[model samples]
Target: MERDRNLMRDILLTLALILAIDAVVVGVFALLAYPWLTFVHAPIAAVVGTTAAPVARWLVVFLPVLALFVWAQLRFTRQELLADVPAGDATRDTHPDLHARFVRLCKQADMQPPDLAVVDRDVPNSFAVGGVTNATVVVSEGLRDALSDDELDAVLAHELAHVKNRDATVMTLASFLPALVSDDRKILNVDGGANLLVWFVLTFVLYLLASPSLPGALFSVSSVVGFVTLVAISVLGGGIILGVLTAPVVLLSRRLSESREFVADRAGAVLVGDPSALVTALEKLSDRGFELPDTDARTHYTGVDGLCFLPYGLDDTDASTDEDTFTVETRSHPPTHERVANLRALVDEL
Candidate 1:
């Protein structure tokens, strides 16, 4: 296809991010487990000398992490991807008209029709998952009720473009990294608040385990206070170090994600031969969007924000108060104004 360059570059970049995340996990766990790794160190030293033992220790942690990542990616089939994100099956038998429209669009793009899914919600949003042969387009009940037929087709075309360019699959693959440090499946920053809390607890437990005199802490209040301070210091110090290492991956993912939306906007317009329809669809969805509730389903939705028509289910929960910047860019999807502007530009060209 004409998009070969963009697709290849994104795939390479996603691979780099996956490797980098694995390295970070190994480095952190290795540092924490260093003292206890002495037994491992001794065996390696006996075979490869003391100088190489440290290198071997890191490899010991790294290899398993890399293996698990490879295994996980291979095993993450369409079934696994759809498991947490619940939806009802949509077939030609159930929705003949929708399927006919879908088939026509696929013919326009010279691709086969993907599987379809629908949700019975009042929200007018949609998302796509998997890629190529396994791809599935998911829509809400309110989407059909809210949009006119042309605007709805434009939105459908947009998601198909995502699948066509394989960006949906790329983002889906990249999501597994953030999912590692977080159970929330939040792509950006990986739910730092909860992960940090886990770090603190684990650090505290280790502090007690590594204590020089556990008997003293049994009676002394000062000893209890000292341990708390020590744990906090260690966790804080580690966060600073780890954050520096992870910043590149986060920034790159953000840049790629925003760019893909623009790419999909243009491609979708070309696919459907109607850019203005998509423009109106984008505006209506953003203007009338509702915040996603903080439920297990929301957690599932967060993982596939890049594929969703509205990022993170339109959950604009970011607190930009006091001009705080960290909470400003929570959504994996690009800003609405930017997307609209880009689509308008496409409308002019097409």
Candidate 2:
């Protein structure tokens, strides 16, 4: 009950944060593109200082547009991926049995059936993408060949839990803010930043030119301080805006992802009614070395790798060291050893 409540809280928080970030992104875009809508008819105030009203007004108009875009993108992208890659032949080898068992598990969890795809790649991997019932569950052929029925069911249930929880879409939406902030940084550098730097330098030159003519030291000091303060505020404000805009989205995404992985692991175990089988699968997969052909070192492993049954690829500790968790950071999936340890602990608890 506690776990379920926490999950509910996380889901609500995730939705709220996504919606907030969506609004912020739209507002920022509109403020950038249409300055007049937000502009106030204050000629005297404008002459003295630029008002923030125009920026505020632009945000009000952009929120709905951005929300629609996010929904449409997630909806259509899932359909396209599913259409291009038809469901794997359940009749092919053990996949059919795996599919039947997975369906049973989904039903037990009260989830609508998710589309499943099998990849012929050598890596032992599986990923769940999409939201609600429109989810896609993908597994590499290597994964099917590597585990027993119960173990496979556990893995599929884990992936299905991801679908039931709508984790993929949440993560994608969460990531949008960071991407937007990063892009906004570029825009500020190109537009706001460049202009400010030019003005600051020009103002310094002008002050120096007029410095000799000032009648008092107080006037000179005040002039220099005022100019420097203006430049400082511009840079600081832009950076603050960028950080404030992205932090909630990123943090919420991470929190939801972490929680969902744990929930999925438990749900998967229950789905097969065999926590030990899931444990066995995790142990086996941990021993099997895996690597993606072209994935970058920074690729997110998260839940996808958290349930894998083995370590993959050649035993080269020095291959990739950029991951936050130095052990499993080499590939898309998290480190097999750590995952195995965690699962074993989870099994003991159950």
Candidate 3:
């Protein structure tokens, strides 16, 4: 019952956050575009011999902004999110056992199997991306080696739970707005975020020349320079201002993300009918990323932390070489102990 409540709460929260961030995006565009509406519609007005309605100007401005957002959302998650993570596709020919296990689990869960990406590392971690219908689950080589069959099934089921709930898609889509303001996320998810800014400036300038709002000239010296400067400030300055507005939503994401992680943990447990297996799996793999055989553990940890099953590698080690476990509220995942505790509680309920 508690798990169900958390699941529903997270679903609602995810939707609310998406709507909130989108609202902020539209609001920012409206604010920036309103000042230039006269220049935007002046050319069209002259062509038709009558001024366009005020709403017409906004519609003209909003259409492109909306289009850009939709395009960015799809391109960002599908292409850029996995651009940095090193993983190869898992095929039944190459990974017969793992592929079979995934297929069986999905059948039990009454969902289709998603594509799998295998990372050739000793780190035991996995995460899902995209939606239920179009999802990819990533697994580290070390993960299969570290856990027992049941435990591996538990971990895979956890990722499958994320796919089933569509939290992975929600999280990826949710990152779009926050990524605009976040440098760390930009590095991973957004290859060149200026697509919107570039498109916005292009549309704004094109209309400026399509028909002149002022009588002198499109390139008039004194007044033209001032008008150009205003346009620059309105468009460029809006980005800086919108970044400030999104800061609060970014903070809100921390809590909502943590909730979703917990829900995935519980849901993954329910999916497999073995909450204790997940608990054991998480505890055994807690030491992941330490003494990693490949790249810098810290960099890789933070790089995939958002999409990883656990935030195991995102922490610092103490002098004794133990994970610090220290975390800030801004972190997208809850602490390891908290996840284990939640799972343990679910076990008790069963």
Candidate 4:
């Protein structure tokens, strides 16, 4: 019954967050469209001496933005998949036993077996990547070395749960708008150089279109003031717009991520019929003091810290300080103690 309740909660939370992210993306589109509608298109229409319907103008603006959004989604998805593939030296092709174990686990979980790889890192971590058909499960060398056979099976089950749930795809889709806005901001900045040359050209074209009707010289005081004001508004308004659209989506994504972790834990525990093994795995992974090498640490943290069995570098204990409390609250995974307790309760019920 508790499992069912958690399953329901996960469904509800996932739906809510997905809807929230959709709304945010739509809101950003509307915000972006307004400037084109009121400023750019209006001026263009005036110059053309034709009044286009508001709906038509909105559609014109919306189509391109929608195209870009789709493109970004595809681009990010591909990048994530590529990122999941092990480097040349990190491949686990020689480990047929591990591969067979993963295949067996997938059969038990009723999920298609994901491609598997082993990272050379000693971080004792694992993560899942890719969409449903192309998903891959990556485990660290340190993790395989650290855990017992049952514990390793439990960890694999956990990663398989992520693949089965399609969490990576869901997360990527949820993060689409944030990524787009961030990347667009970089493109809009002058410092982006050759990469944003097309944007600069577009800006130049707009300037040409707007300048013809103005009375003052291009560098006149009035023109300078107008340009500065426009820049200020773009900076401030863009910040506000991005913040409003991003904050809720990001927060909700994080919440959904945490909820998914719980669901995965439950699902993985059931898959193995050994919640205690998962509990032991989580405890071992949590308490392991292995530090990632400096060269790989940043990439590891950004890539798979959230997907790991436990929060990286954090002990399976209650937060002792105010800062520690904040860190626990903000972490992608739930506190280890809570997760262990939950698994223990689940084991008891089983």
Candidate 5:
């Protein structure tokens, strides 16, 4: 319970940081774009005299282009956001009946039976997805063959632990904020002709907004300055709005992810009788070769790859040195040895 509270606190702090960054970025863009947009466009309008139209006309042209950019982005990111779980048929039943046992345990724990999938890969890995209703679990073919029945049970229980704690929802929501912020940033900056087109349209809008003097009002010295101020305000206002709105959300998500990992690890240990199996599993998985094939943008890592009971390390081999001599450092997963040691301590308490 205390651990859960700590995780919540950390997630909050992370969100605060994300929000701060968002504000700064939006504020800076507003300043630069506001002035450059006005300075360049005011002269063009003076020459063209077509600037009498309302800014709304320019916004109409901008909307479709922005919509296309957003459409393409969602098409790309939708996969990571959702996964298609393979139905557990005969092949899944071959896994020594751990599935049935796990489902029973989940029932006892009052958790849902997570959608189960098994990938035919050599890497020992597993991961869970979905929230309470949509959740599913996946294990690698390699993991099934690698562990003893007890260890496998422990692994399965760990995943169920994730489901029980509602960690799936926590992680998903945590990721969503960053995904949104990233998507927005991409929308604004991506050069699929959209940014250029939007800028052109926005410039036209600014010109229109500047060109019109109030009805029956004579043009005066202040009109030009007033137009410039309005343009600056709009640009800056847009950026600030985006940053202030999105930044905290992203930061909160990341912090939640880290905390949830810790909570899941602890809860997983409790679901199974002993933490030692998890400790051992982590050790074995980390030492074993665990690389997966690369696929373009899909390379963003997810699932049990982060949670496996393994001492994750790079293969340190050298032709020039003796066959027995090697050194490995720097790992994406937390050091397995440290994790095992910690788990052992945790087990002793149990």
Candidate 6:
């Protein structure tokens, strides 16, 4: 009952956080559209006496935003699926015993067995991808070599729990806005700040062209230069404001992510009927000090880190590291010792 209550509380908090982030995104877009409507469309509508102006403005402002959101979600989901594809042949024939164990675990949990992929990396880590009907479990080669059958089964059970809980879909949708903003920030940094400046200038020019009050003669060389400067300042100011507003939402999302890890651990333990197996598995993985290669590390920025069995940077020695203060603030997963302790507590109750 306590576990159920914690799950319910986390779910409610996550939902509320997502809603709050959605509200902020909508509010920011509306603010951006206000100037365009007031200066560009409204005056033209007043002169032409058109009732369709409001509808037109709404479509102009919202249609592309909605389309972009849909496109982003699909694109990221595809990327996640692609990321999980086994780099080498990972068939039942390659490891019959492991396959049999996976099948048995799936049956025990009363769910269809998800496709399993073996990552060629030596990192002892695992993550779940896709949604309920299309879920895939990706395990690393190092993981297969490092653990006994019981420990490996526990790890698989954890990833499968993520699948059964539909965490992939929920996390993907919840993370869409943060990913979009984070990508934009990356682009801006890569382009030496020119991307944002160019975007703002283009937006302003488009608005000016649409406005009947602005004449083409005012678009002189000097005027154009001044307008670009003004747009750059406005864009910078808006970016700062948006960052301030969304920072808390981003932190909240991370907290929700950490909570999901605990929930998955409990669910996985229950599915396997052995919390100690998972605790042992976690300790083994941590002690090995496994790390993903640079190429694979890129996926973590895209939100896949949240789905991993352990937080990306954690190792056995992290507990003794000097960066404990920094780790406590920014680490996505809860401390390994705490998670293991929680599992041991659950074991006691069982």
lDDT winner among the candidates? Answer: 3
Candidate 1 residue 296 Cα shift, in angstroms, is 21
Error of 5 at 332 (Å): 8.1
Ranking under TM-score, best-scoring first?
A: 3, 4, 6, 1, 2, 5
- What is the per-residue lDDT of model 2 for residues 116-177, given as tens digits with 9 covering 90 to 100? 67766556657676754466787777778888877888888788877776767665555545
Choose 1 or 3, whichever is better by TM-score: 3
Shift in Å, residue 29, candidate 6: 1.7
Question: Per-residue alpha-carbon lDDT of model 1 for 1-350, expressed as tens digits?
Answer: 34536755774776577567656755675565454344566788898988988988777766775676556644553555566557788888987877788888888988877888887767677877774357888887888888999998998898888778776556644554444334343333335689888867876666555455332564377667666655565567655655555455555666666667777888888788888999999888777745544443312334344457876452245322343323212125667888898778766765
Give the better candidate number (2 or 3) by lDDT: 3
What candidate 1 gets wrong by more than 4 Å, as runs, is: 1-22, 28-54, 69-85, 110-113, 131-134, 172-240, 243-250, 289-307, 312-330
Error of 5 at 62 (Å): 21
Local distance difference test values of all predictions, in order: 0.66, 0.58, 0.70, 0.65, 0.53, 0.67
Model 5: runs farther than 4 Å from truth?
1-96, 181-254, 290-334
Residue 159 CA displacement from its true place in model 2, Å: 0.7
Flag regions of model 3 displaced more than 4 Å.
Answer: 35-52, 131-133, 183-211, 288-302, 313-331
Q: Using Cα atoms with residue i matched to residue i, what is each candidate's TM-score against the true structure?
A: 0.63, 0.59, 0.80, 0.74, 0.54, 0.73
Candidate 1 lDDT (Cα, 0 to 1): 0.66
Per-residue lDDT of 225 in model 4: 66
Please give, for residues 251-330, the per-residue lDDT of candidate 3 as tens digits.
66566677778888887888889999999888888765455334332222344566778665322332133244322223
* Residue 76 in candidate 6, Cα distance off native in Å: 2.2
For candidate 4, lDDT tens digit of each residue in 165-216?
8877777766665554555213234665785787778766645544533347
Question: How high is the lDDT of residue 260 in model 2?
Answer: 59
| Candidate 1 TM-score, C-alpha based | 0.63
The per-candidate count of clashes, in order, stands at 0, 14, 0, 0, 13, 0
Model 4 misplacement above 4 A: 14-18, 34-52, 78-93, 176-193, 196-199, 205-232, 290-301, 313-331
lDDT of 5 by residue, 1-350 (tens): 56557766775676456545544443444343433333344454565544642243333334543454334434433244333323242234575475676676677667667666666556566766555356666677778878877677777777777667665555443443344444522434647687788888976676555555422233454655666666667666764665565555544554455455555566677777778888777767655654433321111233233333331211122113233522111112333465576678778878
lDDT of 6 at 165: 80
